[model samples]
Target chain A: GLAAPAIAQENPKISWRLTSSFPKSLDTIYGGAEDIAKHLEAATDGNFTIQPFAAGEIVPGLQAVDAVTANTVEMAHTCSYYFWGKDPTYAIGTAIPFGLNGRLQNSWFYQGNGNTLMNEFYATQGIYGLPAGNTGAQMGGWFRKEINTVDDLKGLKMRIAGMAGKIVEKLGVIPQQIAGGDIYPALEKGAIDAAEFVGPYDDQKLGFEKVAKYYYYPGWWEGGPVVHAFINLEKWNSLPKHYQAALTDACAFANTNMMARYDMKNPQALKQLVANGAELRPFSQEILEACYAAALSVYEEISASNATFKKIYDDQLAFKKDAYLWMQLSEYTFDTFMMIQQRAGKL
Target chain B: GLAAPAIAQENPKISWRLTSSFPKSLDTIYGGAEDIAKHLEAATDGNFTIQPFAAGEIVPGLQAVDAVTANTVEMAHTCSYYFWGKDPTYAIGTAIPFGLNGRLQNSWFYQGNGNTLMNEFYATQGIYGLPAGNTGAQMGGWFRKEINTVDDLKGLKMRIAGMAGKIVEKLGVIPQQIAGGDIYPALEKGAIDAAEFVGPYDDQKLGFEKVAKYYYYPGWWEGGPVVHAFINLEKWNSLPKHYQAALTDACAFANTNMMARYDMKNPQALKQLVANGAELRPFSQEILEACYAAALSVYEEISASNATFKKIYDDQLAFKKDAYLWMQLSEYTFDTFMMIQQRAGKL
Candidate 1:
C-alpha cells in the first residue's frame, strides 16, 4: 500500500445534486447524469458524491437551467437548446439546424474555440456548461403521412424542438414545442402531424412508430445535439480544484459513452422497428433544400439581431466548413465504400 | 467549503512511469500520455503522479509492449498493431484494413463487446489495454508519383505500418517498416517509393510534402487507428479502486480529445500542404477495389489458421455491417448534404 499525501488528506467530501432534463425512461440521454455520478463516486471512493434526480423530480425538464441558475441544485444535465426560449444563443451550445455532426461538435468544443466561446455566453447566464452527452445525427422524425416535398410541410403541425422550430416555421409549418413525454400523445391524438425525438433507440422507447407510419431519415434541425451538465457559476467557482477536475473528467467520460451507446443500440432498434411495420423513408431533396434555405435565412436574421449568437454561430460556421471538407474527403469516402460492401453482403 | 470524508484520507500517494511509442514532437499522439498524466495528477491533487518518457527514453517505440510486459515501465502508450509481429490479433486493437472508423471503433469498444474481447487477448500477453488516443481516418501515404490503377502498385516499395504491410504485400508491393523519424529521410532519398504516416498535421511536420508531390485521400488500411495505454496486468490489479477509476477517466478524456484535436488541426494543415505544391489526389477506384480484394484474401488465410484472430475478427465483421448501415442512413446522408452545400460555396 502507498502512503497518503498531504493534498489527499485535504480532499473534500462534497455531495452535489444533478437534476436531468430527461426522464428515467429515456435511459441513454438521462443516463449521462447517472454515469457522471457513478464514475465520480467510484473515482473519489465516496469522497465526492453526485446525486442525480430525474425530470419533474426537482423541477421540470425544460426548467433545468433555471434551477441551476437559482442555485436550487448545483448542476443540471439537460440539452442546451431546450432553453433557447431564453436566448437563441443557447441553441448554439447544443446544435443549430444544418450545423455540425457529432464528430465536428466535439472537435469544435474541445479543439476549436467552442468551449471558450459558448462558456463565455454561458457565464452570463450564471451557468458553466460542459458537454456530457450527444445523440448523433438524429432521425428526421415520425410523420403520420409521407412528406414527399416542400408542399407536404405546409401547415404541418410538428412537435419539433428548439431553434429548428423557428427554421421550419419559415417553411410554412406550424411548430409546437412539446416535452418529450407529451410528444407521442400529441402525435397519436392528431394534434401534431409529425414529431421528431432522438434516433431509433430513444424513439423506439416512445413507441412513435405505432401512431406515425413514416419514419424519416435525418433530423436536419438537431444533428448531433449535445446534452450538457450546466453547473451554477457560483457553485462551480467555489469548488476545490480537485473536485472540479473530477467533474470535468466525469462529464467527458459520460459524453463519449453516451454516443457509443446510441451508435451500438440504434442499429438493432431500427431493424426491429422496420420488422414491426414502420416505414423508413428519406426526406425528398426538395424538402431538404427548402429546409436548408429556411435555416440559413433564420440564422441571418438572428445574426443581425444578437451579437452573442452571431459571434459563436459565425465561429461555428467557419469550423463547420473545414470540418465537413475533411470529413467528406476521408471519413465519407471510407464509409461509403464500406457501406457498398455491406449492401453486397460481402462484409 | 466542503469537508473531507473519512475515505478521502485513505487515498494513496503513488508514482508510476509510462513509456510511450511516439516521439514527443507528435504532440497529438504523444499528448495523450501527457493529458492522462496531467489530468490524473490534478484530480488526485498530486497525490498520484505518472511520469511519462518518450520513445527511446525507456525503450524503443516498437518495444513498448515488451517494456510493459517485463514491468520495466508500469504502463506504455502505443499502437497495438505495432506488435502484430508477435500476433496478428494485435492489429484489431488499433485497426484492420477497411475496418471500423473512429466512431464505430469507439462504439464497438465501449458498448459492443470490444473491450471485453480485446482485453481477453491482452491478458494472454500479461497486459491491460485502455484506448487513450486515435488519429481519425488517416491520409494515404505521400507518393512521389500518382497511383492511378492496380498496375501502379506493382513492384513499388512503400514504408507502411503493421498488418497493412501484409495486405499491401499481396498487391505485389514490397512493404518496409521504417520508424517515423526515419521515414522523411527514407522518402527523400528514394529509399522508399512512397511512405505513409499520420494525416496532414503530423505528415506536414515531417516535411513529407517536400519529397512527395502527391498526397492521397482515405488511408484504406488504417481508417481509424487507436493508440492504447498498455499497463502491466499485475500493476493494474494491485491499484486501489479510486486510482483505477481516475486512470480510466483520464484515458477516456484523452481518447476523446485526441480525435477532436486531429479533426480541428488536419484541415488547416491540408490547406497549407496544398498551397506548398502538394497535389491532392484520391486513390483510384480500381486501386481501392483491388486492394479491398487482396485484404479480404489475407484475412481469410489468417482466420483459417488463428482461432483467436477469427473469433474477434468475425464479431467485428458482424458489428461493422450493422454500424455502417446505420451510419449511411443518418450520418452519411446529413454529411453528404452538408458537403455538397460546402462545394457550392453556400455554407
Candidate 2:
C-alpha cells in the first residue's frame, strides 16, 4: 500500500535497463527475467520499456549485488543467497538446505512474516527485494556415481550453490561455487565430480544427463529456490504508486509463471532423461543423515556468530517444525498411500 | 522412473473411508486430498486409515448421463454442465451471463450449482448433483451467441447457466436444462439460453468443459467458471475406480483443487493462465462481432418471447460486451509488457 505520485501522466514512456544472473541458454530460468521485460512493456502500453543484459555483460554474475548496491545498475534479478559470501544471513532469503518448499515459502512471505524480514535484510544492502520467481524443490545434483553411503561424499569435489555448500563441506567434500554456464564444463572435465543445477527439465537442457550418469534426488540443499528482483532502494522509492503496484503484481505473476513452466516441463524431461540412460538415484540414508547433521551444525554455527542470521533462522526453524508436523500427518499419509498404490500398479 | 515393486509391507493398523475423483491426491491438485486425509488420519494415526475411493465410486457422475440416465443413486460431487440434459446444454455448467465471478461461484457452487443444477433439476426427476468442487473456465456454450448490433437476438434462448440466466435471456430469453444430476429439467425447462462449462480443467473434469467451451477464444461465455461432479452414472460405474480417480481427481482434486488451489499453491498458475489465456483470447473484432451478434439476436428473441424476461434484458445486454474487449487488450498488453520486463529485469 505504499503509494507515490504519478511519474508522468498520459502513460509516460520510460525505458529501464536490467541485468540478469543467468545465461540466455537456460531459457526457463533466464527466460523468467526476459518475460518480465516483455510483460512490463505490454502492460504499460509500450509507454515503459526495459532493456535486459545477460550475466557478465554488466558485471560478473556473482557480483550483481555489488553492482546494484553501488548503483552501477538501476536493478538486478538474481538469487539473494549467492551473496552469502558477504553475509550468511542472505542465504535464508533465497533458500536454505532442506528448508521450506516453494508453497511454504510463499506462505512464509505472503502469509507469514517472510517478506517483511527479507525486505529488512535488503535495506541493509541499499536495495528493494521482490521474489520474482522460484524453482520449486530442486533435484539434488548430477553425480558421476551413485551416492550409496556417507563415505562417498568424502573428498568429492562438487559445484554446488548457496549454503548447502557449507553443509557438504562438513562431510569433507570440497564445494566449488560456479556460475550456471560454467557448471557443465567444470563437471565434464573432472573439475568437479558433481553439480546440482535444478530439476530434470533444466538439468537436461544444460546437458548434464550426457556427462552425469547417476542423478540423485532429494535436493537437500535447495528445497525451494527463489529468484529476486533487486531494485535500487532510491529508484524504488521514486516510482509512482501505480507503477510500483504494477511492478509488484508483475513480479508475482512472473514468480508463478516460472514454477508452472517447470512443473509442466519437468515431467516430460524426467521421462526423457531416463530414456536417455540418465539414472535417477536416491541418496542413501547414511548420506541423507550425514547431510542433515551437517546442516544442523552449520545452522548452530551461524546462529552463534551472526545475530541477524539467528533471528531469521530461529523463526524459520520453528515455522518449519510446525509445518512438517502438519504435513506429516496429512500430506505424508496420502502421498505414501498413493505412491504405494502407484508402485503396486493399483493406480 | 523409480518404479519399485510393491512389497508385502504391513499396512498401518488403521482404516477410514475417504472419497474423491482421484485415488489419492499426490501433487498439487491431488495434494489437497492427500493433505486433508493424511492430516485427518495422522491426527489419529493408529486409530484411522482412510480408505480412498476414486470416481465412479458407488456411482458414475458421468452416467448421471445414463442412470439419472436410469434413476439411481444418492449424493454426487460434480459440475452442473455434465448433464446438458433432457433439454438445452446450459443447465449443466456454471458461467453464462456475464457469468458468476470465480469467487462468487465458489459461493454459488458450494451454495448455488448445488441448488440450481441439482435441486431444481433433480427434484423434477429422481437424482441429485452436488457442487463438491469447481475448475473455473467455462466456454461460452460454444457460442451460437450471434450478437450483431445487439438487435439480432430476437427469439434465441441459448443454453446459458447460473446468473447468466438474467442477462442473456433479456433480449428474448429462453433457459433450460437440468443438473449434471438433473440436466433434463429445463432442456426439459424449454428452448433455453446458451450454456457453457469449463475448459480443459473441468471439461476433463466433466468431460465437457472442452467440448462445450470449444468456441474457444474469449470464452466470453465464461471468463472462468466452476464445475460440479454429477452422480448416478449408474451408481457411478459401481463404485471402485469410478469414485476413485474421477470423483477424487475431479471433485476432490481436479475440480475443487485445480484452479484456486493451483492459484494459491502453485507459484506459476497465473503466469501460465496469462500465457495460455493470450493464445486463447486473441483480439479479433470479427470474432467478437459474431459472438456479440449471436448474443444480441438471442437476446431479442428472448425479450420478445417472454415479457417478464424482457424487463431486465436491456441493462444486462448493455453491460455484456461493454468493456470486455477493451479490458482484454488493455490488461493483455500491460501483462505482456510486465512479463517482458521481468525476464529482462534480471538481466
i-RMS for every candidate (Å) is 2.5, 23.6
Total clashing pairs for each candidate: 1, 151
lDDT for residue B231 in candidate 2, whole number 0-100: 48
Q: Summarize candidate 1's per-residue lDDT along A30-96 as a digit string, tens digits.
A: 8899999998998877788999999999998878999999999999999898888899999999999
lDDT of 1 by residue, B1-347 (tens): 23235444456678999999989999889999999999999888788899999999989988999999999999999999989889999999999999999988999998898899999999999999999988999888799998898889988999986778888888888999887889988888999999988898889898898898899888998888889989999999998888899899999999999999999999999889899989888898888888899999989999999999999999999899899889988788888889999988889
CAPRI accuracy category, model 1: medium
Q: Spell out the clash pairs found in candidate 1.
A: A140-A218
Pairing residues by index, what is the TM-score of model 1?
A: 0.97
Write down the worst ten-residue block by lDDT for model 1 chain A. Answer: A1-10
Q: Rate the local accuracy (lDDT) of all candidates.
A: 0.90, 0.54
